[model samples]
Target: MRNGLSVDVEDWFQVGAFERTIDRADWPALESRVEANCDAVLQIFADAGVTGTFFTLGWVAERFPALIKRIVAAGHELASHGYDHKRVFTLTAEEFAADLEKSRAILEDLGGVPVRGYRAPSFSIDARTPWAHPILAEQGYAYSSSVAPVVHDHYGWPQSPRTAWRPLSDSDLVEWPVATAHVAGRTLAAGGGGFMRLLPYRFTRWAIARMNEEGHPAILYFHPWEIDPGQPRVADAPLKSKIRHYSGLAAMAGKLKKLLDEFDWTRADALVPAQQERARPWRAAA
Candidate 1:
């Protein structure tokens, strides 16, 4: 099976961990490393002969139109990651809609592709934000990989489906929730991001292999910053946040290279065509 591999394209300072410590207004003043980081990731993908989806922040696209073009030129899919990286549940429907529209338009214009995919900042779509699904469908998004089904302090919809499924019974908008595996009677996050960075490479490999063995394609995601260990640290962040954001950074690039070598990967868009033929309305399992 061809599983999905994605990069959440955002700068180090723009991550949720530093949101409280860093003000948006100060963003322009900070040294921007997104371009360099993105270039590195692109090269890694190029070397591996793989194409993955890039969920880019509109703020980054606006400043680095060339980078967005580079991504498109490399044959990777470009998707939206919201305008300013705000959590979905924190935004009212109106706010979320506007943010989505702005980001989509900007990305489409820059990447020269129909921006059909969205992965909310920090995987923020959950039980409290059911409205987000219909809104995405209404706005022309083909799918979203926004729900991380494991329980976490910042985000996760534990009751949500752990596989790819439509969130609404009547909509074509598919929800490709992040990959997880049942181990020792608990659902552990086996996908990418912090888990991929912090956990031993063997464990993550096992998780993805387990899902693939069951005939389900896993959706793994990571940020460009995750591979850039020398990124500037946010000193004011809480210790837990700091650890979550920075743990195992130095080894992430090597581990990612191993992951790419191990898995058969493709963009999230590639999964939709087959899924659409058999798509069903989502209902919480009783």
Candidate 2:
């Protein structure tokens, strides 16, 4: 799509799926791994001259301050991906607020940029937790990319707006849910996450193109772990988790290069104002 791309900057071992087997405390060496992986991502973006948002976990920013600074220096948007990988839906409103505030502070302090956007851990802000939106606004976030309008093993808001739309929670806060494609009666893969790794490259490109054709911006997201297949295995996870995270790791970089070549993408913040105005009926014809 001509819209934009947003990357979640965190390593694979940091994900919640590995929590049961490997607690965050157990993974000390993951720090160096994340730093190396993030640099690889920076090289990719640099080669393409692409400026995209990097929603970083507070933990990542805290340890890798130089990386966060490099992202801002490269003219990319810096948004929070929560303090840890804790799901917003699982936290009480106050707890969730704390996580968001902490993450915002950490990112801003490190990047010297105002962190106004958030993407929930695991894309967990679904219908059951509609309250999360209003809470996000109340906590001073300007936009959220936490919901995906597709069903998955962890999180999906099937009925949420597929395109960018202002939330009733507060006029300033917008909802830019993950892009989705219709297959039969179901919402199929649109952009990033496991779908980016699992689906064929052509399918992902087609889904994004369809969104642009419909006059919407596709928000593509990916994790650092998706590109690192050599990462230590989390054998404790159910068979499905293993397949989801590791299935196509080797091909991710090539697929991403093709994506950069095919789509006209940029950071979400750079496109936010126009996207917000475009959502207005009065501007639709313009």
Candidate 3:
């Protein structure tokens, strides 16, 4: 079972946790650490002899074209994390389409790779944004890893399937959602940034192992900023947001290493193809 490994490439100041405290216009003044952090991430996978997808921000790609080239050169899939970190639900349909085209064009030109995959910033595509996946398919996105099956306060569509499925009836574009596993009849997020950081590593490993043994590839994701402990902290942010963003920064690298060593991991592009037999039709609305 070759599971999916992904990196949501964005700088520390750009994450949603700091949305209220950090202004997007002030982004240029922030000490940008994404390029160096991404290099570290690439090295981790290189040392482990693994390949995965990098769902890169267009903001990052436009500034660091060389970094985009490095990602492509390293044999990783270069996918979109949107033009900025705007959540799908927040954007009107037209805004969403424009953002999509702008991001795909920038990424493909810089990376020299067809940017076929997308992971919405903050995983914000839910029932509210019923048109999200269909628009992605229309824009030439072969797939999206945007849906997280577990419902949380921020974003989710829990009724969706656990396996890769075509959300639009007419298109082949698949929604390869973040993985989850059932525990006592409840769905728990098997893997992703916050869960991987906040939960005990043993639980994540157990969840992934259980999911894999049950014949599903566990799709795990993280961000470049997650590993940077020295990142500038948002001092005035709410305590919960501060804790969620900063508490586990120092330990994320080691956990990623363990995942690489213990589990069979592959790029989403490679993993999605094999999931077709398991793919079913998923409704955009409940």
Q: Each candidate's TM vs. the true structure?
A: 0.97, 0.93, 0.97
Which scores higher on lDDT, 2 or 3?
Answer: 3
**Model 1, span 33-142: residue lDDT tens:** 99999999999999999999999999999999999999999999999999999999999999999999999999999888899999999999987886899999999889
Which scores better on lDDT, 1 or 3?
1
Off by over 4 Å in 1: 284-286
Error of 1 at 254 (Å): 0.3
lDDT, model 2: 0.80
- Per-residue lDDT of candidate 2, residues 90-201 (tens digit): 8887888888888899999999989888999888887667567778877777788887777777777676667777765236677787778887888885777778788888
Candidate 2 wrong stretches, greater than 4 Å = 29-32, 280-286
* Ranking of candidates on TM-score, top first: 3, 1, 2
- Find the 10 residues in a row with the least total lDDT in model 3: 277-286
User: All predictions: root-mean-square deviation over Cα?
Assistant: 1.4, 3.9, 1.1
What local lDDT score does residue 167 receive in model 2, on the 0 to 100 scale?
Answer: 61
Residue pairs in candidate 3 whose N, alpha carbon or C atoms collide under 3 angstroms: none
**Cα lDDT of all candidates, in order?**
0.90, 0.80, 0.89
Quality of model 3 by C-alpha lDDT: 0.89
